[model samples]
Target: MSHLEREIAEQPQVLRTLLRAQAAPVGAIAAAIKRFQPAFVQIAARGTSDNAARYAQYLMGIVLRMPVGLAAPSVHTLYGAQPNLARALVIGISQSGKSVDVLQVISDARAQGALTLSITNDANSPLAQAAEYHIPLHAGEERAVAATKTYTAELAAVALLVTALADDDAMRAALNAVPDALDATLTLCDPIAGWAQRYRYMPQLACIGRGYNYCTAFEINLKVTELCYITGVGFSEADFLHGPIAQISPGFPVLVVAPSGKTLPTLLTFLEKLKARQAEALVIASDEAAFVHAQQQMRIPAATPEWLTPITAVMPGQVFAMQLAAAKGYDLDNPLGLTKVTLTL
Candidate 1:
């Protein structure tokens, strides 16, 4: 195993601690978001932050019934916006709050009259200093650059924030129990890492998820690209069958963050198509339907409320990425050309 992999393997205990440590702030941030209640909510992040952006958008739309939009950090500062950004509530998420672009945009948003909030791991970082409110993930020092606990913590933090805003008692309960969900997901680590090590060289990998796990699919692709430096894509299962299936052939590996909702029938249909194409496939799910089979499988504990399966489903994938990167001796702690924070315009 690479140094980063060893570091990650040693991290679950620490991660569990971080998860327990941040519950209050997570809840508080959600409540703070509700208080803002601006004309609209704007999210900014590059790469993985972009993944987080998608999750934020999904949750706000799916769970909170709010309209959430995405904006790159550059647009608020350098790109020039047509509409007044003055009343928009912008929440910029960065693991390290100091990236040049992120900082510039937070300043621009403020100058235009928007309420800016920074969700970061470092409260002392530039991005955190620029925003009016800071929701630190409290994830502590992440040793490997390819984020693991920090990203999960950020997801939990966002969930807490949204739950607070929408008076979602059910979601609030989910947030409280998330660490347990995370633990259940971790149990699949050995199996997932085995897959990663075995398939490290597989060409053209695809990941699919429906509903909330869609964001998890995005995150898995991000980890693969950043660490293993592979060409990977995350798509909705149904959408993939429509056009993307042409790219899948023998030896191509696919990952499905199988949905637990009504989408299961659709997922199984897509799986059949994948089978017909003779492509390799992996599925992550918890449903105990009367029938189930796949080319490869990683099962997480069944999560409550079904749509929240992403909370549990993403753990093994993160571990899988870490192990694959470790096998290649890739630097997981600090991925090439990236930092803990991006203070952008």
Candidate 2:
């Protein structure tokens, strides 16, 4: 079995359940919010962590109406951006609580008066200690350097932060149900893996989303390139029409993440345009019936409150990238030229 196929094969029990259990940390983040609510919020991460943090930053600024910033660990240590350190709630997202650059960024945030919080799998790592407050991801020592469970746990932290900021108790309840929904999403991993292996040779692919998931497109694109050594691009549904449409040629796959959200209509409209352009589209949609296609559709569970779609929607691409790499006999546990922990401090 391919590394991704094996990961998917194991999803029926262990790691998938680990991904589902993310709600456990949500309560801790809620408590952290009550303890530290700064005017500005900054996220610390590197590479994939930064990709996840970018999604969280969008959720904070656009979803929760908070002043959120993406803190580059190098900028604080190398150039020294005081703007991120001033009264900001710096949340560091690292699988290992010891990423050198992420730690320095959080430490700098603290030195300049920002409230620091670290969400990491390693409870005892230095990154955890650097934060004034800590909400450990508890993904339980993910060995795969590609980082699946840790990514899900970080988004749980983001959802927890958003839920805590909202005054609506009903929304909090809705947010709490995400893990169960995520449990259902794990079922599609194998199907996505099957597709990735079959389509590995495709030169280009599209990963599109809207609102908060617009950032998911970037992260997904990153993963595909990082793992599969193939080129893929992520964009918003609205942004595709402006210029990118010209690039949609035959045999090019368009992977659309269409969750049933406020932007569904716009995304569907964009897909229709792709269809009219005669481009092959493989939609990873919750409402699969809404889209008719000759190729099989891999549908995950629907996302509630619409905003949390990115949390579930990104999983398929995560699996797809790994599967594509695994198809080429690449070991996903540690992709070449990648490290478990990145420390630049």
Candidate 3:
């Protein structure tokens, strides 16, 4: 197996290891955050980590009721602008703890007396060292140039923090089922391996999702672009209807992530419209009703908490991207000029 494929297969075990080891440390951080009582939250990340941060925005907002902001590293790194973060909880997330700008954001937030935390695979790396607390991803040495396991590990780390803060036993139990859910989800790779051949010549596509899975759309698009070199765009269901829907014509390809949740109804409506326009859509949904509106369907495990669906729903899309890359005769483990760690500013 290629490094990418192995890393992808390793996610279930990686998450299981993380949940077993991180609960207590994560709980301590949660205790600290409760004591600090920050007014809002700010996160610093880039690339795939940035997409994980997007999941944080929705998860923290809905579950913890804490407003969250994505930091523009340029403000601190290039323009030298220091926004007062004293009353905020600032978080830095990176697979490698080496993103210069993300590290600078954590360092500055710490200096400004903000409660700072970092989630990274490297516990000894600089970003972890700069933060007041750290939650190690425990995803192991991910040799894939395109991240597979680390991205899901990041999502789980964020969810672990939220579950710790909530201190709800039922939610904790729900989280324990995630590894099994992921293992079940991985079976989609078999079907994707065959289905991807149909899209071998697909030049471009749109990926759509709403609510928590909004991040899934973008992250899946990133994977497709990285591995298959597809010109893919991601959009929220509403955003696509507003203007971008005009761009869709008969036989246009669209990929969607609409698991069984509150988001499914509206997504079904969106798919209906796409059907009217004769778009060829492959929808990832757990609901039987949703299948009626698509040319193709991939089902994930049903009843995954809406907040955590992004964690489970993304796996099938990753498999599709991997298979699609193989179908197109493109590099999977190492894309054209990409590297595993990217440093900015």
Q: By TM-score, who's the top model here?
A: 3
Superposition TM-score, candidate 1 onto the true structure: 0.88
Number of clashing residue pairs in every model? 21, 2, 0
**C-alpha lDDT of candidate 3 relative to the true structure:** 0.92
lDDT of candidate 1 vs native?
0.72
How close to the true structure is residue 251 of candidate 2, measured as C-alpha lDDT? Answer: 60
Q: What does each candidate score in C-alpha RMSD?
A: 2.8, 3.2, 0.9
Q: Report the error of model 3 at residue 265, Å.
A: 0.6
The regions of model 1 sitting more than 4 angstroms off are 1-32, 80-83, 288-293, 329-345
Q: Rank the candidates by TM-score, best first.
A: 3, 1, 2
TM-score, structure 2 vs. true = 0.86
lDDT digits (tens) for residues 1-345 of candidate 1 = 444555444344544565577556656765665666687788877667667777888888876677788876556567765346677778878888766776777778877778888888898988899988777777667666677666776676677677767776776676667666666666666776565678767656798887777788989888887788888998987688789888888767888887577777788877777778777777877775412547677777766556556666777677777878777777777878876544444
The full ranking of all candidates by lDDT, starting with the best, is 3, 1, 2
Question: Model-by-model lDDT, in order?
Answer: 0.72, 0.71, 0.92
User: How close to the true structure is residue 93 of candidate 2, measured as C-alpha lDDT?
Assistant: 86
- Provide the TM-score for each candidate, comma-separated: 0.88, 0.86, 0.98
Please give the lDDT score at residue 332 for candidate 1.
Answer: 73
lDDT tens digits, residues 1-345, model 2? 434444433433433343356444545655666666677787878766776787787777875788877775667677766554666788888878778778887777788877788877777889888887776665555666676666766776666667666656786677667766767877765676556668767777777777777767777787887777767787877888788888888666877777787777888778777777777777767786536642546576765567777767777777777767777777777777877776675
Candidate 3 or 1, higher TM-score: 3
